[model samples]
Target: MSNLISGRLPAGVRPQSYTLDLFVQLAEKTFSGRLLISLKVEKSLQTITLHALDLIVTETQLCGQEALVSIHPSDETMTLTFPETIPPGEQQLSLAFSGKLNQQMRGLYATEVQGETFAFTQFEATDARRMFPCFDEPAIKARFKVSLNVPTHLTALSNMPIVEEKKVGNLKKVTFDETPLMSTYLLAVAIARLEKREIRVGETAVAVWTLAEQVSLGSFALKVTQAVLPLLNDYFDLPCPTPKLDLVCVPDFAMGAMENWGAIFFRDACLLLDENRSSTATQRRVADVITHEIVHQWFGNLVTMHWWDDLWLNESFATWLACKIVDQWRPEWDFWLSFQEGKAVPLALDALENSRAIQADVKNAAEIEEMFDALTYEKGGACLRMIENFLGESVFREGIRRYIKQFQYQNASADDLWTTLERSSAQPLKKIAKDWFTRPGFPLIKIKTSGDTLKTLHLSQQRFTGKKTGTDLNPWIIPMTLKYEDDESIHEQHILMDKQEMDLTLPVQGSLKWIYGNASEAGFYRTAYEGRTAKALSEFAAKALHPIEKIGYLGDLWALSSRGDHPISVFMEALCHFRGDASRVLVSEICSYLEILSRQIVLPADHSRFAAFVDQQLTPLWKKCGWDADKDEDDEKRLVRADLLWALGSIAQDEEILSELPRRQTLYQARPHSIDASLVGTLIRLCALSDGGKRFDQFIEKLERSKTPEQRDHYLLALATFNKPALACKLIDLCLSNKMRAQDI
Candidate 1:
């Protein structure tokens, strides 16, 4: 048995394909399976070891000959020792195994919806062995043919389209076509009474599946995929490999979505969208989530990663590409800025000190699971953006197309991609990629500009430690860009800062109104200004600048302030300019930052002063949106108003807002449908915060009597807001004790 957990399978034998036939007993919460594995032996071997977990192997055979099976449950493996040596040649191994369908969401698990039981599978980064034993590592890619026997009333789905089905009395046996060569982690299955909404894109058939009652809500997701998949195909210059793509919404999903080769599974919250009742934010999220999973059809599923260490290669590319595609699909959403604010900035902040690199080292199952974090998704995308901006998008896309064509249906490492990109762009991409991907921290660029007559820009780089002192860490190959004040010739200068400090000759004019370092926030590094450049940024931010630039400046300012490089007052002064900023995303971000400072950092004695500051800053927005929803308000206006109300009413503890909640609560309970859907959550929370245990009990009763999912969720959140530990514990027990539905859990 292999000793390394979640590592590569031994090199002597390689699996070519798997044929699995399973009988699923939903009532028993168990499954029995027979698997035939085709293999190619590189050397003569007396024994072969394969991964299997929580399963009882009844018998084993090699090439139709009985073999001795020794099980080592600790290593999740079973070793079969043949009496005679198996020579280097093609061979087949077969096994009959049975395992319980556990409740843990890791492997094949069953959930009860209403009164019926449904089974689903989630096996990423290591849990596939529990489903059906085979070579479970990412490098061992193979074709899969799956057949399942279940009750005749249920429908079964796999990674490929259904090829055949037969019924015997009360059970149906369903078979799926052979899937493309892929890793075991991408294999998925769901057995339920699923209703599907279908669409066609060229030769490909796409469908969105959910419960029968929620089938109508799946239309928005289907529409999104139909509109975006073709654009992605055009962008990649490559077609999806499968003829059918099935998107299923499961009630209990571990993550937002899984990028299975052909069958993608999403949480109900992410996939189901009712256009009439959904907000603008909900629409944007649905688009982003669907686009992200679809792009993975090519980027992640077609061209695979060799190991878990380079998992970022799949996630980061998809993260950036999702926004790139969505921006083209819906320009009014301003997805690029959303990407910067949501992904890039937060990741940069997370990568300050003691943060993992883009390409992390994963040794065990737990480490591999933990690697699917912000560094891999957000920072990884930011670094990719940095590379793309430096290499030019045309060249970047060209290289990507070549890379996909070269490594289709195979596993490749980060270097394989860098080398391919180097071929197209003729840049030192391998060096640039290694410096950022291997390091644990990000660089902070400090630019010092002096002399009005002839300005000289001295730029220095160091690892940002969130402290005042600098660390002796290795420098990065920064693809840093600088934009001067409105001179086309000097508008942009691309520099690769390989050393600690370098001097550049800037063509000075007048007093240098502004200098945009990390221009357009293209680079992943933070920038700090000194001398006249600092003054220029302050003045320009106060008067004229794009909303994105304002976001970038404020983000960098807050990051620097956290590191003691700048004062908190500087951030406050910069934020004052956004008092009248109409961009909903930006306004929400400002409100979030204020709440963070007040809740996480400020002392108890300073609460009154902090509340006053928040009230003053948000008063402009409050005046615009008002306490109640205006007649026929814009979608963005409604979203901004709800967010502001949550911040001001709850976090800021506004007395007038708190005072009005009891009246609103009584009115809402009398006529629940009359209250605005957008502000009802805030009203519930305020009700709990204003009146303690009595309001909480009332909210719980409201939750029990609620008919709709939205109101139930709101009431649950309000019930969770109680400050008393005993009450919080009671709410926790109610959630975990199975009193709520599985979907709610």
Candidate 2:
């Protein structure tokens, strides 16, 4: 290959369509393929270059003549040098190549389940080159026609449904229908001995595929899809992109899920649910993962991102919209409250000195991989939520609908989306949203009152960093809301804070109890209240604030205290005000914060004091919920019970919880399903930690009998919790051995 030094391929020729035929040999772990690509040559040239990695090309033919091929490993490109200069017109390039079915969970890989080998593909973020030779960039959209030859007993799946199948001796050739114009990264294929459970959502055929023994485990996922698919269709104002949709649960997957056009791939843990064994958290996770991938069929598959730099446009929209759809479907689950707690992760990451922008300039494969972090998914989603709250939900929904309709089956940039939204709402969006998209950090709003009555509020904004920096920072155009309680009633005021500092005078008849910025936890910024205001808000938060707002309040204070903006004592003092709160979301957050403090901050000499403090806060709630789940209890109570059990047994070291572990373990051993599914894992871990080497063999026996993926995970994690040094070493060796799946290791 010619020594091209650029990170991206030269753009003289583009692929219009591809016809790929492959013979997969699962036993030998290798595959051979012939690729016929229809190309549109933009300029007359003697040579053409495209991406290929770890593949051997046996033959190359162009225009019915032999073409010279050279492979460049440095840039993962294959160059074709023709005998004569090709004209600027349509042409066909043919190549026969072979590659190994890699063990790595990317490209075309092999995974073993129940002593059977299956081949799967994961080609996003530049791994498509590892699978086949092609223009493996997101902007080069092309139609694909794929045909796979596999053993007769195996089933073949791709981006489209199988159009034809023919048996030839012991092998079968499966040809899929041609796909819509799409990016190469969205192409997928699977060959496995699989069984599927199918259903119809509107005119679209939907199925969940799994191994035969686990086929029944997909019932919950099927139910979730049956509800979520039509909701998204109506919301987007479009039909499903493809006639059929398949959600496949693979034994080995690198990510939570991959939205590969019509065929999505998920890890078994993310897709399968054992109703008798899986916890409420697992059910919630299954719904979230399924909904997230389905949303991609419209946002990321139908309307693709132009390049890697705009990856957030595809991922953030899917992340934000999935939460919206799932919350609507299961409002009783209080899903948005969980979302408010989840935002704390990205907010903390953004406060660091080395944080990257929501939209960073990606130059190479490594940079592209770096883009798939908390900043892109969590922070980006939070930014979109802030925008939606500002623009009004209906107005934002209309703008998104227009965006998808305008750019379906094509590539678009972040600017294209912003422009479409601006036109839909007739609002100036680009200027207000530019900093959030391009800047590295978020703003921290500090409040100060001028008058003794506290009606006149002065707010200032600056870039918040975990550590001090000398660089000058630019101001963000913030959409803010203040929720305050006066003597008469609660009131909300909305403002667009575009300047460095702004002042507002509240019109109140009586004294104002408190003013809370970041109302409803909608904005993507942190709020810092003055001393007396912070105290009063914390004292009255249960009565005055929504559950979601309470989570946001605690999360912000926890983050600020961790970064040394305030003392740890301040957060500890605030925790005392919520002792009797019944919201599971708030209680769970409090437990998590206390656990972290116990592990990372409390001194050994003062550990008992801290444990006593935790017991004082959670014991009454634990007594109310009890160790066993009540038949008439709500999901929130069950979840809160699980959280409290974990905190008391693991962190607080409460003697009542510790002494009851043996009895709980005995009861679980007697009848596994009799124990509360949500608390089983916590009980196992605590028992293992408390019993140590005495019951190691018994725990091992229980692990060997584990049937579901969730059970296996709980056992494996419990095995690691044993406090003996010898047991720890044994666990290390067990992980290094071939007994466990790569994902578990």
Candidate 3:
């Protein structure tokens, strides 16, 4: 078996830089490449090994001298054994190889868009071996100079700006500028008949590209890119490394976006927005995704992780910073509330017995693929935000500036970041953050009040799990922030809970009513209290708490209720009390949790009764948001309206909604463009719930006539919303036919 633990190349050799010359034949779906990689040899060795897969190594040379080459196809590697032991020094290894472009979306692949095939690459998490022969690990960061030969009709792009392009006999030879020191996974290339819209922000040139017919939809991405780059440059306190940035909307992309140095690649859905058809929510997503990829240009591309094990270091900062930056850009969106909702995901997922730690063990390719999960992205980001809250935003910002400055153009580990923050804040981060990173599960802080005066507070923690898994893991160093009953002081009791139990004696016990931990929903843990305490906090959540805190209270109640640690009545009571006061995000989270409880917890025989309960719980929100038509509504209104309608249609199955389906279907057919963009999906789902075989056929017709990418996505989602078994079966059969696009399917 191969060395799965490290996944490292053999000792005695390391790559410094690579010079690649590639000839891509789009029609034949194949490419031939010549590579000359400079290496820093440390010790004398007979054989040099590097990662390469699915490529025919035609020739090899060591130190410009002939060498015998051997290929290990099963292990995705190659070895060149020279006639004698190579001396330690700088040396060049030359190779010539050819490989077919893969249909699989990994590595150098061919994607057909509108009947025209285009070549693209996705090499993150060890797939770079499928592209060329090299040391493909993240720490082996190297500068790359690439040259591509493509048909004259196509435009070629890479990780760097094009330095030279010329036509020769119906073919174009495109040479890109040498890239900064970056990982092989960040290396990218695309050759297609594309169009771009460009803008200039400061000295940096930004451009967004897409298919020729959809170039107009690229404007929104371009606008956001121009706005966020300068803001990010200012925030990181580091100048943009590259003079130009390019974002390409690939017709078929496995991930939302790949931050490939200067040239970022995005799935079309994430980057394109048609003003006529897309909703305010779609625009927000476009901005968020664009800002995310651009921030990666600094965090992930400029200063990368030292190894795949520290991949969370690359994702977490970008994810958190994207929310922060977008919130700053649009304060009205209340993005932090949405951020709180996003943070709740990891808390719930990590509480499970099967969940992984943030820094997951990626011993092999399969494990590496799984690391890009909720824990790494959501939990990691939440941890950073919690640290920010504790250390103060100004101090955290300074730490980030120092981190980028210290590790610019170099790989850094998780400890490097903590060390930098500790330096900035002069706080003991290592002690507080160690368990958070190393431990596999999150903690639940239990609160109980005792003493004759009911003023004594007791707090303890144990690993949280769905089943009774027992307390096997050690306690976490939780950063707890608590607010007492009716105490409006911003500087409440903040403690670093390094032990299993903590007891605090209140100075005055006369009227202390309740205490809540992890206030503002900043920390990545759950909290529960004793009977009287939980009830008091539940009531407090109904009136005095911040919206995020209320959301947190509801979430913890649901978790405790589901585990039977707390009564489900407590959850329902809190939902009823907070319904009118909850924000759009809280409403959305409530609906989401109720949906899960209905599916998993509610008995099959009690499904109807549970649905009625949900209808009653959501009634306040439905009345507040209302079912009405309005123009020029804000994103919050749009989102809230959609969520309420969805809960009403799916859970309640109200007769009014069922009766209106036919009329709504007619309106959708006659003036589909006039339907509220946010409610379109909900309306289609209502139709599906109402015996929608005929409506399904009409949706297919609309899908065929979709003029914008957003319309296509909406139609596809509508088709997928069929709940009826027969309709779902028919939808699957339709997907197998030629009508559906492979990417959409």
Candidate 4:
């Protein structure tokens, strides 16, 4: 171990290219590799330091001669000392090394499914060192030519298309073409007995690979990839960089997905879909995750962040752009509404005192790992969406296209993106966006009525801290859109609320019926209205606002009430106006907020009354959705039915719902495929919660019989909901047992 102060390697020497060859033995769980790295040294030096971890280097040669090697396990680095000074010029370094095929799901690792073992690589952050010795950092970009020697029965894949293959006895040597300049973390290799469904999207060959038995399940993902690739290309005004795009479904994956140059890796649940047994929710997830990795092909791979500190640059852009392209492909999905619902998670997390900024300072590998949280993906994405609204869509699109073209195949910082956008749109963006990227919490805008007329309104901004009043005095440059209606028509006015307080006069002919802040839910900030304004907006929200705006309206009320800024009755009152709303996205938000209120605020003595209130609000919606599925029903209708059934059964505890559960459970057990896919998990959970002891053994049996990853997840989560204490302990034991995958636990 070396006492290196900095987590980064010294700046004098860097790699220009890597030729990595590995011989992997999955049965023996070991791999041996030989690496030849082309380096360019800036100045004369006696020693060169690079990154390596858990690797045994058998031989080291610099410029085809012997060199002294020193391994540092503490900082995961290796130094090679030459007998003579190496002047400032290009040099070649080669090493022969061996390492274990670890089970920790990092670097070169093995995953076992059933009785079969496969090798895969997950090298993001810093684990690339564990595979082979190189300068493993995002800023150090290098081209790679990878070759793998594996069993002849398996298929090997890497960052590029296969260039050559030859058989050597029981093993095959497969060499891939040279990849574009990329970070080491984005280099991937996978070896498995796989089958693929391939399609051609323009010049790019897109394929989804999975186990032979699940090849049919890759159909939906294949279609989604075909649809999204062209949309992304058109949006970026650039063609796909890679000639081949492969989406591999790993059986045991630690992350939802990893965007590895042309070879993207996803968990089974994210990439494989059984249409007959999969829910609309699963379909949406498959689309979103697939599109997200595709977007990264250009945003993160072509133009990467210079350091881990600006990781949000890679993730946030991918998150925002993926939604944009997917929405363009399937407008009927109402994907932005789903985005709004997902935004609440990070909004809540950001309100905590201990929350870190979107662009926090990251030093070591552990700190870099911590940056991949909800704040980086969700909050950062929401902020980007807000900025896009501030700058019109066309302008934002042009700015992004320019940014990609200018920084393609290079490294960039967050400020570089902002500067490019500012130049393209001629908008003063950095002044407004700096606070959002560097600050932890968002603002809460308060709307107050001025005088007796309905034309004038006063607005004030303050940081919103959950559960307490915030004292942070820094003001954000907030973009706001006010929607107000008169007797004749509705109108919109955009404002830049850059101060602590501001007053605006509505441009209405006569009297204003109501004014709703945060129209279209465009801004990331929350809004609070005065009593009269809140009442008027509530009355007109269902009719006047968009479905997403209606959700944002109620979501703000609930958030405000939860923090004691207003009474819980205020949110309850707002719920009444939305009782007749039919959008599944809005309904889902309402159900989730109601469940939270029931758990946190409702008194034990008033439980029955609260239940009755829930029944009154949702029963009619459920009746409209009905107990069965329609053959031609839209996805939203199917989703709404599932939401209503769950809320009515679990939260409201409606007698009718409770009575129907036993019959549904029996039907599901008899013919699970015959049941409505959206209702399967709900039925399983309702049965478990209602008949805990009797259903425990039944659930365990069903879990053992679960065929798909989705079914297994549903059963596992359902098992945790059982009420008995002994059953809870048994569930924990099951989680720790060999039956569960380490990733799941």
Models 1 onward score TM values of 0.95, 0.98, 0.96, 0.98
| lDDT (tens digit, per residue) of candidate 4 on 565-675 | 778887788788788788989899989987887888789898899999999999988988887898898889989998898888888898988998898888887888767
Q: What is candidate 4's CA lDDT for residue 719?
A: 91
lDDT of each: 0.82, 0.88, 0.82, 0.88
Alpha-carbon deviation at 611 in model 1, angstroms: 1.5
**Better-scoring candidate (TM-score), 2 or 3:** 2
Supply the TM-score for candidate 4. 0.98
Q: Over the stretch 1-745, how does candidate 3's per-residue lDDT look in tens digits?
A: 4442344677678888999999998889999999999999998888887888888888888865777777776667777778888899999899999999997778999988778889999999788888788898888889999999999889899988889998877888999999989999999999998999999988888888888888999888877877788889899998788888999988788888888888889888899988776777788888888898888988888899977778888898888999999988888988888788887778778877877778866766777788898788888888888888889999999999999999999999889989999999999997777777767888888898876665688988888888545465577888778877633333356777878888987664365666778778888888878867766776666676888887788888888887888678878887778766547888898888777877677888998888788787877767766666566567787788888777777777766767777787689778977677777767777776666566788788888888777778877888887666887888889888867766677
**C-alpha lDDT (0 to 100) for residue 732 of candidate 1:** 80
Q: Report the C-alpha lDDT of model 1 over 364-446, residue by residue, as the tens digit.
A: 77788888888888888888998999999999999999999999999999999999999999999999998878877777788
Segments of candidate 1 deviating more than 4 angstroms: 1-7, 344-352, 486-490, 628-634, 662-680, 697-713, 741-745
Quick one: ranking by TM-score, best first? Answer: 2, 4, 3, 1
Residues 1-745 of candidate 2 have per-residue lDDT tens digits of: 3567644789899999999999999999999999999999999998889899999989888877777888888787888889998889999999899999998899999999768899999999898998889999999999999999999999899999999999977899999999999999999999998999999999899999999989989999999999999899999999999999999988899999999999999998899989867899889988998999999999889999888888998888888888999999999998888778779889888888788889888887888999998889888998999999888899999999999999998988889888988987887889878988888888988887657777888888888877644143577899888899888999988889888888889986687888889888999988888877777787788688988888888877877787787898888887887887879999999999988888899999999999999999999999999988888778899899989998998889999889988998999989987898999988998888888678777777777677787888789889988999999888788778767777777
In model 4, residue pairs whose N, Cα or C atoms come closer than 3 Å (at least 3 residues apart or on different chains), thus clashing, are none
RMSD of 4: 1.5
Q: List the residue pairs that clash in candidate 3.
A: none
Clashes of each: 0, 0, 0, 0
